[model samples]
Target: MTTAAGRTLHAGALLPELIAVRGIAAVAIVCAHALSMATRGHGGVPPSVEYARLIVDFFFIQSGFVLAHVYDRTWREGRFHYLTFLGKRLARLWPLHVVTLLVVAALVLAGRAAGLETENPHTLWSFAVTFLMLHSTWATSDLAWNWPSWSVSAEWCAYLAIPLFFLAADRVRGSAARIAVGLGLFVACAAFSELVLGADIVTLTYDGGAFRIIPSFFAGMLLRRMFDDEPALVAMSPRGYAATVGGVLAACAALIAMNATYDALWPLMVVLTAALASRAAQPKPGLLRGRALAWLGELSYAIYMTHAIVLQVTFTSAKLLGIGHTFPQRAALGFAALIATAVVAQAAYTLVEKPGRSLMARLLSQPRPARAFAAAADRTGAGR
Candidate 1:
């Protein structure tokens, strides 16, 4: 099927393993949020929870790879319609964003009415920023409503720059050169962020977070380019693919064991994402390609967007019920919260996101009446 950007994307164009990874990333992020809540105002966050923030970088990289895989060809052929592209991206992201923002707002109002303190930003300016998807820009702090949507906000900025990024990538000539340059750029950007900005890339907020996403996004494009140029890498045997995946998993285990910081593990993450993406292109039945993982992957975006809200509600309700202070109780409640998040995300995907996207696509694809009339007039004049 061709996307609104006029890019042809076959069903197989989507790599199942990548989808599975998305599911995993979504879960990690949710766990991280839940853990943070459980440990609120407490020091010593578990290393696993702390490192889970790198999943956002993985998200950026994956997005870049997927977008390039689907749209780069059309872009190179000069068929990419920027407005249509932006509309499609907005359609995909905005509906759930608005819904979650409203949910958070209502929760805040209820808390206030009950004489409870809510962490949500209740000001008009914050609402406007969240609605405009500008919450991650330098102009604002982290959004009070739908705090997790900060990544989505950062992604919006990347989506706006994708065309230009692709244009630059197109000029790099060879896939090897492009990949090399992309890695170099990533390192440079990481250094600048760490050294000059004096901010850990993983902990970046505001405009700093926006800067954090660019390198991974570009690296993802480079990975796609390399995959396209070198079929051998993706043509690995099933055993070889399994081994590569196993190695990546082992590395993740080791990182967790060592309690590596997000900064220490991000480069490894980029390499592993690239490697796994390459392996995913192979026609093999990997663990990540399992039905359960695939389902979670399909719902990953909804999960990412709604999980924080779900966590907050779950914890708040638990607190009201006096069920969360004890470790065992909190653990049980957290598990239940995860289940609830999945259920709610599934509903959002089926009822809101899918329909909203279809509607938006149809609306954006329709021709303007004035343009239609002008075209008809030109045709009539030609007939004369």
Candidate 2:
């Protein structure tokens, strides 16, 4: 779908800034994961781990926002190209993914060659699972692949459902009816998750991280629709912003008090964020709309896709230097790893993902020239 003004509303006017915040969420999740590994005992989680888990809810919310942006733009434009849209997504996401998968396989083969670990059925099975991107990050099993990749499974699932959303919204006609259907589909999907997986399975927890994230993803779709609705259902009115701030504090308290037990309140984080985005998406949010955050947002996918590998390489190198696992030691190690991850992710983005995106952009673009990537995104947003 292409926008006539060459400006398709993303995250309903918070496109770049919202994506910038996604960078912060990626950093938070990776650091929290690494720090929790240092802090948790063999059998149980520390209180800090609970804090870490809630942060993932932020990721789910962010995913929903992007998906909605994609779907709405596609439906509104009336000219979404299926092949080009999916192709762009593949170019943007799959290059790193397929490369990392092969890299893991190569590393495993090398580990076996060096006698670090023996090849066995269980080991081979672990490789097979991760090759499919199903290996859980928190599972006790010694496995491979990008350890943070369970979300990719969630991402692809959302991709599959997007066409269905586009059809419902575009074909269903009346605005209220289209919205009702979208919300209905979102709830039905959520109900299916609860019924099939149990209520506790909502926040991408346990095995839910593998598949149960559809609800959160769709909740994002619904919220995105709400953001675009004519009446401005969730725009940042002064009172609405105040309530969102209050709700965030409450969500934090519940997250802490529940000790990572509550996955149900995850949608609230998106609601709160959309309120803030309502403000930022307005005419003047100044530095929030600056170049740095947008650059970070552009690189955010690389940071997410590469950070775990960076953490492993950083840790493996540190281990070679005989670093210990003391609290302060691990904290310093984590800090160093974050810095290293940022540098490597930037390099990877420049060398791999960015160029791949550019090639796809040029090839799949409308034959006529467009002014910028926003116009390009507007052209290909349906497929994106």
Model 2 scores worst on lDDT over the 10 consecutive residues at 1-10
Candidate 1, 108-193: lDDT as tens digits = 88998999887544688888888988887776755578888888888999999987789778777677687678778877887897
Candidate 1 TM-score versus the reference: 0.90
Candidate 2 lDDT over 1-384, as tens digits, reads: 322223224543446556777777777777776676554343344564555555555676667667667656755777676666666665666677766667656765776676655332336666666554555433425434565666775565556556775654445554466446645654676676678756544444325564556555655666666656643543345566667767886877776676544544554666665665565544545444678877887777888888877776666566667873566676687788888888988988888777877876667665645467677788797786
TM-score of each: 0.90, 0.75
lDDT for 257 (candidate 2)? 75
Query: Model 2: residues >4 Å from true position, as ranges?
Result: 1-14, 40-45, 118-143, 168-195, 202-210, 233-243, 258-260, 360-384
Alpha-carbon runs more than 4 Å astray in model 1: 1-12, 41-44, 375-384
Q: What is the overall TM-score of model 2 with all chains considered together?
A: 0.75
Candidate with top lDDT is 1
Q: Evaluate all candidate structures by whole-model CA lDDT and list the values in order.
A: 0.79, 0.62
| C-alpha root-mean-square deviation, candidate 1 | 4.5
